[model samples]
Target: MHFPTLATPFIFGATALAASLTQVSNYNNNAKAKPGMWVYKPDTVKSDALVIAIHSCQSSAQKYFANSKIPWHQGSDRKGYITVWPSSTTECWDVSSKASLSHDGGGDSNAIANMIKYAITTYKTDPKKVYVTGGSSGGDKDADELFGMMSNVLAATYPDLITAVSLYSGVPAGCFVSSSGASAAWNNTCSGGQSKASGEAWGNVVRNMYPGYTGSRPRMQFWHGSVDGTLSPNNYQETVKQWTNVFNVSTTPTSSKPDTPEKNYRTDDFGSNVEGIWAVGVGHSVPSHLDVSEAWFGL
Candidate 1:
C-alpha cells in the first residue's frame, strides 16, 4: 500500500525572503536510478549549507515539496542554505538490494549522494554542513516492503557525506535484510521490534556500510509517534538502539524534557549527538516538525 503524503498544509504566509525553485533530471550520470529533482535556492546565501529532503514511496519530489508544510525552504530563505528534493524512480528506494546496501553501490542512495555532490559543486554549498530529513517510508525502508525510503539509511551508507539526520517513523538501516544474505521483502522479526542487539553489534552494521572509515559519524535525531501502527512503535525502539550503538552513547538519556512544542511530546537527549522524540497519542503519520527540526539542524 502506498503511504499518505502525511503533511500539514502550508500555513505560513510569504516571507520577506524567497527561494527560487528549479527542476532537474540529469544530476547524476552513473546512478542506477535517474530520479527527478526539485532544487530550492535562497536568494541570499547565508549559511552556505545544503539540505536534501526525500519523498515517500509513490510520491514525487514536487508532491513532497508542495504538499508538506515544512518550512525548510523558508528556513533556506532566511538561513541561505540550498534545499533539494529527489523522487524515487521505482516508487520506493531499493533498500532490499545488495548493491544499495553497500556504500558507493549504484541505487537510489547513490542518486541522492550524487544530488548532494551536484548541489555542493554547482551551488558551492558546504559539504560538512549537509543535513537530511524525511518521513515514514521517506524516513526508512523495511525488509517486509511495508515502506521504503532511505533517508536514515542514506546517512549510514555514506556517513562522510551527511552531517546530521532527523528521521520520522523510520526503521533501522539493514533491518530488512534476512539472515540468508538475501533481501526479503518481509521480515516479521524486525518490524515487530523483536530484533534486539547491543549498541556495539548494531554499530557494526553501520560501520560495515563503509568499511575502514574512522571519520566523524553523522549525529542523528529520531522521531516517531507513540501509537504509530504501520511501522510499529517497536521500530522506534529498535532505531534508538541502532543509532545509540552507532553513536556509542548510553541507551539511557542524559536529559529529558516535556512541553517540547507541546505537552505530552517528550524529547529524550541521549547525549550530545543522539536524540529521540516521542509524540504521545500520534500515529504512523507524524507530520514533519519544521521549526523544531530546523533548530536541531542549527538553521
Candidate 2:
C-alpha cells in the first residue's frame, strides 16, 4: 500500500502548533493522568479538537508518538489537530486486570478519563470534537464487562464528555466475561473467549453507561482489517452494530465503497453519527491512513 499524503484538515493558527511536541502530566491527579505526549502541527492551537491515541496491548505512548518506523507520529503531526498519547500503568490497557471490572472502574480506565479532563481544561480542547480511539485491545477495553451494569469503566464510560469514539480490531462491551466475577471488580482478568452479542444487546450496554442520559451520545466509527489476527475481524461488524443501534442508525449502511470501500474507505453516514471502514490485507495494526481516521471525526 502507498503511504498517505495526509493534507486534509485545514491548518490552524501558529499558536496551536508552536510546539512540535511536549510532555504534559496532571500532577494534581498524577496517578490518573499519566505523563502523556502532546503533539501539535506547526500552526495548530488550544481550541483545536484532540485525538487521544491509545496504544495496543504491550505498547507504550512513546512508541506511537515518536517511533521512527511507524507513520503514526507522522500523520499525528498534520494540520488541524492536537494529539495526546498517554501510557498505561500496565503493558496493556487495564482491560484484563481484575480491578478494571470494578464499579468505579480500574485505575487505567479512570485515569484516561482524567486525562480527557486535563486536556479540556488545560488545552481548551473542543469538547464536541474530542475523540477516543486505539489499536487492537486498546480500541474497546471495557465493552466486554457487562450489560447496563453502570460501571464507571473505561474512557467510553464518560460518553457525556466525548463527542465521538472509534475502535480498531476491538470487541464490544460484555464481549468477554471476567473470571473474577462482580465481587472482584478490581480484577481485570477474564476467562472466556469473545462472547458474541447482537447490536441491540451491546447498544443496551452503551445506554447503561450514564444513569440518566439525555443529550447526544458519542458518534462512533469502526475500522479493522479483514485479516486481523490479534482479534477477529468479524468483531468490527458487531462493534458497528452496537454503536449504530445505540445511535439508532440504519441496519444497512447509508453508503459504502470508494468513499467507504471494501478496502481503504470511509463509510456513508449512519444517521450522521456512525461509520465503518475496512482495510483489506491489513492485520492487527493501526489503519495506515491516519488522515482518513482523523477525517472520520469530521476534523
Candidate 3:
C-alpha cells in the first residue's frame, strides 16, 4: 500500500515513497520477504541537527505523517530536522532469525542503512545528529536491530549517523524471556518461568554492547504509561533500570506536571544523560497531546 499525501497546516518539505520488497540472493528464495514504505520530510530552515527516523507498530508511514503536528504549525518550529518513518513488513518486526539481526544482510537494518544514506545524499542531512524513536513492539525491536547487532553496520555506514534513541512503552527486542516475560521484567523481578526469553536475552546484549562502545553512548529516552495494560509499564521501568545501571547514570528532576486531574505525570533525567518518564493515566496507546512525528524528529 502507498502512503497518501495530505495538506499540512505548515510549510515543510514532505514526500512519500512507495513500499517495496527486495530479494536477497544469499537468503533462501523460500525465506519470507519483507516489504516496507518510507516517508521523508526535510527541515524548512537548514538544520545542522537532524532526526532521521521514527517508527511504530503495525502502522503505515502515512499514518505517522498524518498524526504528527509539526512545531511549524505552532509557530515555534525549530530549525527543520529530516524525518523518516519506515513501515514494517508485518504487524511485528521479525526478531527471530539471524536475518532479523541488525547486521544481517538485506534485513530491516540494511533497509535503515540504505535510508540513511539516501537521506544524507539526497537531503543534505547532518551526519552527527541523526536520531531514532518508536513505540511498543517497534520500539523494542529497533533497539537491538538498529543499535545492538547492527551497531557495526550503523557506525560503518554512517559513522556520525546516530546520536540518540527514544523508546516509548517498549522494552528492547529479545528482552522477554517468554511471551509472559513482560510481567516479570516490568515488576523488576525475574521468576523462573517459560515466558518470552527474548527480553532477557536482549537485556544481556544491551549490557554487554552499550558500555563497550568506542563511540559516545547515544542519548536514550524512555517513556511509558503507568497504567499500560497490553504491555506492563513495569517492563519499561526495568529497561530503564538496566540502561541507568549500565550507563552509570543518576536521576534528576526534569519536568513534573499534570496532564489532567486524573492524569498527571513527571519526567526525570538520569544524570542529565538519559531521560525516563512515566505518564500516570495514559493507556497502551500514544499520549493524545504529543505529536508522534514531531517527537520522533525532535522538531
Best by TM-score: 1
Question: Which digits, one per residue and each the tens of the lDDT, describe model 2 over residues 1-299?
Answer: 33333432324344444555555644245343243445443353423787777665445666555555434445555545667676654544554333343323534555666667777777677778877766433223323212111121342457776777665655564444356543223222212225557778877765664546667767776666666655566666777777788877776877665644433544645667877677666666434355655667666
All models: lDDT?
Answer: 0.73, 0.55, 0.45
Q: Residue 86's C-alpha lDDT in candidate 2? A: 68
Q: Point out the worst 10-residue segment of candidate 1 by lDDT.
A: 138-147
Runs with alpha carbons beyond 4 Å of true place in candidate 1:
1-20, 135-149, 178-188
lDDT of 3 by residue, 1-299 (tens): 23343444222333322222222222222223343535344325356554533444445555544444322212113444545555556554433333433332454555665666566665666776676655333223222222221222232223335666655565544343233422112212221112233334434555442233445555666666776655566555565555565456543334444443134656666665566667776656434233532453464
Minimum summed lDDT over a 10-residue window in model 2 is located at 143-152
C-alpha RMSD (angstroms) for model 2: 8.2
TM-score of 3: 0.62
Candidates ranked, most accurate by lDDT first: 1, 2, 3
Compose the digit string of candidate 1's lDDT tens values, residues 43-123. 777777889887666667776666545556667776777899877666566666666667887766777888888888888
Better of 2 and 3 by TM-score: 2
